[model samples]
Target: MTWLTALRALSAAATSENDLQQVLDLVADTARTLLGFDFCGVLTPDAAGESLVITGWSGLSALYVDRVNTDRPVRLDSGSPSSQAFHSGKPVAFRDITAEPEFTPWGGVAREQGYRAIVCVPLVAGDEILGTLNGYYSPVHTFTGYEIERLTLLANHAAIALTSAHRLDQLRQLNESLREQRDALTRSEQIHERLLGVTLRSGGLDGIAAVLAELIGRPVLIDDSRNVVLAKAGNDGELPDAAWRAAANIAAPQSSAPVPVGSAADPTRRFSVAIAKLSDDVAARIWFPARDTDLDPVAVRAVEHASIVISLELLRIGTAVEVEHRLRGELLADLLGSGAVISEQVLQRAHRLGHDLSRPHVAIVGALSVSGEPAETRLYQRSLSLVGDLVAPYQPRPLAAMHRGNIVTLWPITDESHESGSAAADLVQRAIGAVSRTVDATVAVSAQAADTATSYGEVYRTAKGALDIAVRAGRTNTVVELGDLGVLGLLLQLEDPAQLVAFARRTLGPVLDYDDLHHTDLVQTLRTYFASRHDRNRAAGRLHIHPNTVTQRLRRIEQLCSADLADPAVTLQFSAALTVQDVASLN
Candidate 1:
């Protein structure tokens, strides 16, 4: 074949989608035809580097090519052309093969194969030396320098082709990876949409559990503290051994807390069990199963998010029910008169309903200026919510209603040992403290009643009086006990606002004048002193003034009022004067 024909054949072989062996065969045949060689072959390094395999050959017996020991290194110092060309990264030509010591072992075989002279060229690309290409002649011949150069150029072209094939393999692998990731994302989106639709339509916690189970394609079970099943999905039979063991471990008293189940099986299949405390007497347990897939990370995360939503809904529902029950009890109380009959009915109802109302209780009345029709209703609802949290533990069965635009709650105590009047006073005080912290409002507690009947009337009166005092005194956050008022308490007991104001003027008129003339806080100082029980040190500390200053002021106060400081009767008179002073100050 002519050089033009050989070049055409090489171009076609390079472009063909064929196996490496077939391409190597075409290259060897083209090289022999173009160079006019008797024999030609290609050698490639084996993986272990112990030998070079003859991948393709032309003009040689298949048996002889197979037997060639190309693996062992041929020494260049011994003057073998093939070994010299491979090590030097250049072509080598031998005009006389028999005279070369390095060729002695393989010379006989070559002669038998009808080859006497040989030329070899190294196949190299960049810094990589892949192998050597060899050609043989039928008689002793000398290769021209031009021919050796041409063979080197051919070898370089082959090396470039091999590098291109390697790069293509890498790109194919990367494409496959991206495809897998895209497919995974699509699957995740589908699962999310389906799960969301199911959960939304669920009427309660049970629906939520069903949706989660369906999404995960696994079993789920939910129960309350009584082990009564609230929801179930997937398998209805007994749980698997692993699941059962997990449940048993979490069934312990201390294990009432949430347990992340299935975390042990597959780190990615992270199922969890959670027990939520609804009230002191109520709790719920939920089981979440993870999806079984290679995408365990995604499945586990989705299940965890779903569990959180379920837990929150369950807690909200439980709280709402408690509030509803309390409101119902309060409504029942209001329907009956706020008298003895109502007290007896409440006690009897507690016994019949098996509710433990035998506890210290108090009536708390909360007054807030609610405006905006919608906002006012919401505020009242929130107030009921607060009352439920406060009374649920005591089983007081709070009765609530909107009385004169105020939220009034009558908390009933069935325990005969607890004085209703005292209990009511304490409850009002606490309610004021708690409510004030939450809102910019004043709260008051009515005096505790003897029973439900007396409680209705007394609670309203005390609450109204406390609220009036709170508002008039400019006390933003305060808990006032009507019983602590002494003479003022008696006036409040008689519901006489006019007498209360008159007493204030008689006792505090002179002190008020001293304050006006000196531009000093005598009224404030006097109130603090009285509140501290005449303790000068405590009064000074509260006022952030020197104790001596408080003492001097108290002496001046006694002189101005013409009251004896050493007499207990006079101290009582001054204290009553301060209490009544607040009533006038409020107005």
Candidate 2:
């Protein structure tokens, strides 16, 4: 057949939408016929750098075809004409395969394989060399220029077909791979969603831990700061010494480590430790075997998910604990306000809420005259602590409350009378003194009530009264007793501002004159001074003023009254006079 006829036939076959192998077979057969060669075959490079394999052949036996690897690499840099064509990116025409220097090595193999002459043309696109198209013959023959050109054109067409086939094959493989990856991702998401749902519904950390352990196929344990075991799975044996060491280090700081856990002879002795800090005072560590086969990616993911679940659970439980504690305090307050007698029932309820009921109780209340910011909170806590210390010796334990932003506390009081009330009031004054030393504020103490019910209310009322008096009288650090103030206490508790002001003006006429004229704060100074038992340091703290200022005000008060405050009789008269004025002004 003519070369043009062969080209026309191959083109028509290539456009027939036939499989690649069929197209290759047709081309190989057409080449053998048109080129007058006994043998013609298509050889493609394999992945490995080895000999090219015959993909399609016209005259080759089926045995040779079965033995070839289509993906094998061919040595194209050797001196053979085919190698020359491959490396030089051109076509090579050989008259005799045995005579060519490059073909000498393969000449013997070719003779053994029944081949004589061979022509090779490289299949190239852009700069890349894909493989080679070859034609072989059993008889040695000189190829004409026209025949070589025709063969070269045929090789180019074959190269285009092979390239297209390779591309289509690659696209098919890629599409299959993408489909597999997408399916895997969908399965993973489904598993994650199910696991999340199970964790949310599970009762505690153990449920989540168990689920994670099952999912990851590894042993696990969860622990809190108190060294309490929250959850565990797998072997029940104690953690190896190395693992314990790792856990200890993790507790100190957020970190991870691998430590040997088993026998020295064992190759799989290491455990991976992951630490996460939940809060300032809490942390968790996860330990899993570090052996490659034991802890896979799934195990790693389980550990991660478990950490989140445990952390969230801890936060929820901790918040609940705190809320329950606060609620107990509120309930106690409610009971006190309800006039219920303090009994074992109330004590048990308090104990259950984490309160030490054995402590003697003294109720105290404080009001902030200024904004309640961070600093104020600190001050309030400190004040509560100080009050706790003062009341601690009197009770088995001490507890304080911020009853609606007012500082209130209860002390275990064994004795409730005038003397005990005096002592309680005295301790409160000292607490107020301590608070004043740090911040500018006043505090009040109430007389001890006969029982918890009346005592809590009385202390609350007294503290509120004292706060009101401090604001109006411009006083600080003073303890006020409702009982001691007599009818005046009733007036102070009456919620009448005019009554309070009138009483203050009437009773302290001389002191007010001095205060108004000399711009002295006698009323406040006197109140705090008396509340502190005339202790200059304590009074100054309550007033949040300089000790020297307290001293000056006291001096002015004595001067204006022209009375000797040093005399017990005179002090008593002044106290009674103020009490009367306060009561009378109430009307």
Candidate 3:
């Protein structure tokens, strides 16, 4: 084809062709065919623009092309024909290459390839030189003006096509990058929206965990500061307890950023964790048993968002629990103090808290055997917690409360408690076991009439009185029940201290007055003698006095009371009177 036709074809290529490599290849082939040369090659500037590298070649050996592109590329200031044509923006011609000193370095290449005449033309698009186009002639010949002009025209057409193609490629790449960024943003918003949905639904820790696990495609576990698992998902109902236990003990994180419990690069330990502090004593830890690659940014953000949702959920739950405890506490206080019938609103409230006021319940009261006043509210609160937990798992669950410096339980009657105080005894045993593990040492429980209290106030009062008697008598970590104490139960049930004193005075009144006036050991000797079963030596040993001193005191007691110590009936009367006196003193 002629120069004009070839120029038209190249112009068409500039409009139609978008591939840079295809444009370069077409330029090289058209130059070699139209210029009647042995070989032709197209050179483009490298990214650094310091040198020209061969991008397309026709009728050239691959070995030479490779060397030109790599080992010995054409530098813009290398003084070679291609570099001169590019810098000067003009066509450079080398005739009779065998004798030219400028072509000495490429002389052997020229001879081997049978090229003695060469021409280099810069491919210019407007003011910028995009690259260089070169043609080699085997025969030595001088180029006509028309031929050089035609070659220059071809280089101009090639330059325009190359420029258009380069810009098109750039636009295409920019479009691609923008598309990828849009896709990433959509994915991020979706993740955040899903997590927000969980919070809006008030899905507790388990719900948060399930959604996060599904989003991240791994097992998720949530634990508190106490190492107890609050929720878990996607573990197939099995997890390494030791691993989670250790993970829960992490340092309280100030931020909710995800922390790696184990390196993702390490196969044995692959866990990512984030923490949310629920309170001063509690923290919620989120864990992921992920695979061997670090979590992507999306997954990391999901974990952080989950930690935040967990914090909100815990706050909501904690506030609800506090409100529930306050309401229950008020109800229990009224029940322990009032003898009136329970109102409907009170029953409904109790039902909400899982209490059945209609059932037959007995009051059990327990107190610590230690003597000092229990001034700290925390101590009672802890004791109440311990007591409540001890009886929480029973059927028809009992209601427990802290009342009047003691742990009071309203236990529901069952067949197992057929006997009076049996259920109370069991409750006391459980309380003792539970309190022993707490900061409090132990407790003494009392239930006077476990199945027979006429009113709520009477139930509490009898239990309270018996607990007081038991604790004063050093009965720690045990139960006190009237049915188990035989006749002593009757003496303990005496509600009047003056009546007890009057009965004691009726029997031992004469001797008691004489001992007080004379300041003698007669009453003490009588008690010791009876306790020793009339053994004078044993009674003396007990009082640290001689047998003769015991005999003298006993005879003096008999003279004062006008009673016969040798009579069995008189001895029984003294025993009854002394028992009443002792019970009165403790009461």
Can you tell me which runs of candidate 1 are displaced by over 4 Å?
Answer: 1-186, 217-298, 304-362, 365-445, 448-461, 464-498, 516-519, 524-551, 562-569, 582-587
Model 2 lDDT tens row, 1-587: 88677777766665555666777787788888877778887766546755566677798777545543422224645566656676788888887877777666555457756877788877676677766677887788777778778888778877666666666666767888898768756655655565567657865767775676677666766665434466677775533343353344332444333232434433345555555456554456565555566554444555665666566777776566557437646755764575435567776776664456443344555544343222366456546556655654642444555565556655556665546655655666567446544454445555544253353554556556655555455554455556545555655555345655665565578996776788867876786777788789999988899999988777777787777788888677667556545444433
Q: On residues 1-587, what C-alpha lDDT tens digit does candidate 1 reach at each position?
A: 77666655665555555545666777678778777888998776666764556777888886677557542334344446665676788888887788777788777667768888888888797888777778888888989988888777776766555445435445656678788767766765665555555555655667767776766556777776445567777776433334453344453334333355543433444545655553443356666553444325455544544554555667667566666656455554553345444455666755554343344335555555422121255455545555656665654345554565555655665553335645653554454334323554456665554353344555466566666766555654445556645554555554455776778778878888888998888778878887887788999999999999988887888889987767888777777777766554432
Across residues 421-450, which tens digit of lDDT does each residue of candidate 3 receive? 565656555654453333323332334333
Candidate 3 positional error at 530, Å: 16
Error of model 3, residue 408, in angstroms: 2.6
The full ranking of all candidates by TM-score, starting with the best, is: 3, 1, 2
Q: For model 1, what is the alpha-carbon lDDT of residue 406?
A: 57
Error of 1 at 388 (Å): 4.0
TM-score of 3: 0.48
Number of colliding residue pairs in each model: 7, 25, 0
Candidate 2 has an lDDT of 0.62
Worst 10 residues of 1 by lDDT: 369-378
Better structure of 1 and 3 per TM-score: 3
